[model samples]
Target: MTLTHTSTGVLEFESLRDLLRGYAGSPLGMGRIQHLAPSLDRDWIEQQQQLTNEIREFRRVGGRFEFAGLLDISKLVDEACIAGAALETTQIRDLIMVVDRAAEWREIVMTPPAAMKNWSAVPNISEGIADFTAFLREFRNKIQPDGTLEDRASPELARIRREIDKQKRTIQESLRGYLRRLAEGGTLQDELVTIRGERFVIPVKVEQKRRVPGVVHGSSSSGQTVFVEPIETIEQNNDLVRLLDEEQAEVHRILLEMTRRIGENAEAIRNAADVLAELELQFAKARFAEDYSCVPVSLSPARDAASGAD
Candidate 1:
């Protein structure tokens, strides 16, 4: 229900609408009503068809529906999906129902009735209205077989994205700092700093320190180690090099622990995401339903003939 106008001078209407579509398309959103009703019987199917027709008719005229009713639309679609017999035949019908419902909601929002004007009218409702209009148009166009991401997104998803980005940046910067420390001879090593693209790390022996004069040529398990000169710096930077190795090892351990924790909490995180997503979608459905519920599909001529002529 909270809303903030963006610097672009656009209301969050499109964002809200996109969120509604997401809920309508999700398993939870679609499942709520049918799950509650406890019957996917033939009688239920007939009732849904009748409800669909009524919804269509309601749109044809200007009708105001409660927020609860908008969610019912998604429930109905989900019910139809569960109804089994000849349900495939009703696919187009169900889509048309949603489309008609969505259009009705769009029109209502575009020119909401006085009773529904919960907020002060924007001085330039056009900018806000236009933004919402474009969103719906694009949303309708993008309604595809795969089920759009719009149906599942919520402000929470946006927040999750922001948090992930922040964490990633923090990790990146910490690594860079770790590299810089290694470069300033912060470690007691005379080891040369090697740079390869953005990756920064100091190479150190995992085993005992060894010095070789007269260009020692050797190989490890990987079979590729050669020296052009004596390895005098290795002995000088030994302690510093060891310090860097310890730091890198600690960092690596922390990273591994974090990954493990994430894996352990994967289900919890996913559940939290689903709840937020559903809430967002619910808000969207309610908002759209409220907005379009009262729009008149057809206009009548002015009652005052003189006013009409003017």
Candidate 2:
């Protein structure tokens, strides 16, 4: 049957969409709700009800599922249509998280509890997705949850981080010695060695600026003190900066590698994302039915009659 805004009253559909929105777990599912309409096709409605009934049975058996990393990645995938397209580190990480969740959900579906074993309508959505977990394993250890490559993501990254740490320690030691000397000479304004523009510096009295013999990065509001990066540690600071650059380059290489790997498995990843979204949508409808103690759409005589008349 054909159901339009006029026949159903736009407000009625809007209200139901609003209710569905509350139960939707992800942007994909929530977005689909606005397009929902009553259907008179008995077979399609029965299929939906069968799935919902299976979900209800699973829930009655104390089965539960939680979805994660539901960020809509369709745009990112579409953008990757180019031959050499690259994704940002955060986007790559998000894609990895979605694949990981899909694999986990696939496992749950494959090995349902005793109560769900006989439920024929249970959707095996992850079937035929070839080795999603193994493909994603290439990134599992490389990227951290905060969207930064781990220092141990590769041997080069680990080596660069170690050198950076050593350089930092050397700089800190030199700065501390300078601080001690300045304190002994009564030229120091404060005992703290702070950071300025990514370089370690100490605050010194304006009168003692020449005594410190370093680059004056800035000064206090009253011009009573200057922040100085002592000359003694200048070379060490430069080394540290160089190592930091190397670290950044290494991170970029790792992220690029991840993006490339994603590109290789892009189609499977997109398919997995679609499956998860559909699962989320179906589960959301089941949850809404459970929460409101309402009948499934297929079994609602009033809705069936209204749509059948058209």
Candidate 3:
């Protein structure tokens, strides 16, 4: 008879599953533990036992195996597969991590330690994995670890960012004299420079806003101080905004091209994830078995298995 939900709880099987989940390294591995069911099939039981035993041995020999840092990129891959899509920095970073992990997997799985060489439980997963070498190299060349594109990502992007930086330094220098001028006029509410609606502005007394030729952005909460962008900095701020817009366009273009590259191997990526998840699940099972002093038991042909395990 199949174990019902109530029976599972009473038998402490539910709690056992919860304990097993703690041994898993990733969401995918934990999901496998969560969906586990009691099985009576002799072959299936034997396979599970053998795979767990292999992993225990694999670890005993100082061989490392886990899915610790692997992320669930299936959703991202789905979005990347869309035509003409442009992924943001975080999304691209996730993809890069996956590709890098795949590269590591290729090396380890293909040439395992002599102790694990005869084990068929962990087979070569390279065929299921896609060749992301070109993509990985290109992404590394174009992107930084901090979610920013390198200056060489594109000529126009680099040029625009450079100009933006130069203009910002100029604005900072100019603000000093401008703030001093306003502070001297008794029109300044605070001797500071701040941004309002993306333009640099100074806080001036409400009545003094007309003291200088400037645009009124907003006012402080008390409404006593109004933020005004002096007429002198308007042309400079406008240039900065224009350069920013160009940088955004270039970033968008690069992202779309990268997304298209990801889409080209979307199917293979999913398959590779499945292969990794299965390996992780087996290792999790091994660790769980070790912690709980558990062993797989095969039922007799007459279905009269040892009463103790049940």
Cα lDDT listed for each candidate: 0.37, 0.77, 0.79
**Candidate 2 segments whose C-alpha is farther than 4 A from its true place:** 35-37, 80-85, 128-130, 297-310
Worst 10 residues of 1 by lDDT: 122-131
As for lDDT, the candidate ahead, 1 or 2, is 2
Descending-lDDT candidate ranking: 3, 2, 1
CA deviation > 4 Å runs, candidate 3:
1-13, 38-43, 124-127, 141-146, 150-152, 296-310
What's the TM-score of each model vs. the native?
0.24, 0.88, 0.84
Q: Which residue pairs does candidate 3 place in steric collision?
A: none
List pairs with backbone clashes in candidate 2: none
Sort order, TM-score high to low: 2, 3, 1
Error of 1 at 40 (Å): 7.8
Q: Candidate 1 has what TM-score?
A: 0.24
